[model samples]
Target: MTVVISAIPWLVVSLVGGAAACVPLYGGNVRRFLRSSLFVKVVMWVPLFVAFVVAVSGGLLTGLVSGVLLASIGAIEWLRRDTAGRTRWYLALFVASCAVWPISTAQLAPPLWMTYCLSSVFSDVTAFFFGRYLGRHRLPDWINRDKSWEGVLGQLLGGVLGVLVLGMIFGTAPTLLAGLVIGAASAIGDLVNSVAKRIVGIEDWGSTIPGHGGVIDRFCSLNIALAAAVLLPR
Candidate 1:
């Protein structure tokens, strides 16, 4: 609760600024923009964003609850989908990572979890926005058709920006190097998830989140980002 309270101002800034910044990307096509998946994606992601903040920054009890919920949901979905057992090994690894992440981050001081989580979420947002608007070169067809160099750059920018914003709000700064590390980890996580989905011959891990496919789909970057954050010099 305290973490959430302290981060409210930062959240508002991110949300409003993101929306306003995206106006140019629409290229004056208001109706098209409203009808696009980008709008739906933003709307769907906001609620989950709050939950992630709580899980990472809301202390031991909240972390445990979030972990249990993540593990249960993830297991159910994996079992339901992977009837052929193509993903069992990966599923075990993912579930274990999900279960452990919140508990691991519980030891971090105030705003550290916030910084890491926000960096990850911001990386996703900026990557999607830039990729949608400016992507010219597609990544390898095997890795991800939707990813691009521009989007990767956006991910790095988002990471740096997240740390800078939180630094101002909390008056406790993490080095920009931490942001870069988190960003790179996030990009790798996303790519890895994409590859796994391709190997499984599926479009998403699940359809739990409306626009975002599944819980795993939404959280892959975050889990990796937090893991990377753990290695950052505190």
Candidate 2:
């Protein structure tokens, strides 16, 4: 409870900041702002550097640094450019990274957490690239076109393979199961965000991260995957 409470402010700031950033990316002034070298230098590059520092630090320090960095980036983006669709991809990546962090931290054994982290990253990265490269079969029109069965299968296979490799090293069912479940949940979270962005008619949730988008974009998968792991049995 204490940990959860402590995390709330950071979480809220991340979400709000990210949403604010998206305004510029999805707005109409993207091209005009891109031509401004000053905007790119101070507005774009600086916040990303700060986020990198915060993320690398990884603790209470991360929370404070990341929150401030995200807010600053969002504020700047909101005040500058507008480029839609691109932000969604960035957001997806961010959410995926966040999803893996808790699983990395929750393990009682350091080796187990390490294995889970490696496996989770491998699974998500493989699935993402594969899905993007080979995703031909789209879901029904009712579903978001951005998601495909190809991506889902890629996630499943990548996740299973990742867990299998990690389990071979760690030799633990609980850890393997946790990694697999978290990977699947991360994919689901990605789908949820895709749907949200589509429904809202925005691209990218925000432009806080240089390559990434907003806090929601960065942490959407992490939030869902962690929540699922916490609520589900085992």
Candidate 3:
């Protein structure tokens, strides 16, 4: 109840801000905007958010179990599909590091856990839009062709804003710092995941969700963000 109540204002800000930004991006074509991939992604977030709320509400053990299950699925899939032995080893290490954060963060307060998860969500959302609309300098074609510096700037902005909005729940100063750390870590996590896919010669980790490819695809940045949030001084 408390979690839902606190998230209402933040949710409204994110949705309204996202919709407003799309207006110019689509040249006022509401129909086209509604049909866009961004719109689909936004719509898909509903179920994911529900699941998140339930998982945290279930207490630490449940969150830990859920994290372990997800990590195992992602790790097995990624490792089994990749043919490159050396890179597969690196992927294993990466997956293990990613797994630790969420499992550990399960012990934290629900609001803090939610903040960690949502920071990455905000970063991902804003980066996609800003990258599409204002991106000029492209990232290396091999790692991730679509990413750009402009998108990164947008991610930083989103991360900061997300934490600020939830400032009443967590202390403002610490969360602001955590936001920056989480934002940067989120970007790195995303890039690493993209690179892993490129190496494996696959478009997505799996096809479990519509609009969002797989659990791994959707939550790639989350564990890293959780790590950042957890590491912050209480």
lDDT of each: 0.76, 0.52, 0.72
Which prediction has the highest lDDT against the true structure? 1
Q: Write the per-residue lDDT of candidate 3 for residues 37-127, one digit (tens) a residue.
A: 7677666777787877777776666676677777777767665666465456545645666554445556667777777677778888878
lDDT of candidate 2 over 1-234, digit per residue (tens) = 232233334434533553344346435475554564323432443343344333434544444454455444543443343244444454434434443343334432333433343444445555655666688988654447766788777766666676566555555444456666867877887777676666556667565544457656555555455455555443
RMSD, every candidate, angstroms? 2.3, 12.3, 2.8
Off by over 4 Å in 2: 1-110, 166-176, 229-234
Query: Model 2 Cα RMSD, Å?
Result: 12.3
Q: Considering summed lDDT, which 10 consecutive residues are worst modelled in model 3?
A: 166-175
Q: What is the lDDT of residue 152 in candidate 1?
A: 87
lDDT of 1 at 89: 75
Ranking by TM-score: 1, 3, 2
lDDT of 3: 0.72
Q: For candidate 1, what's the RMSD?
A: 2.3
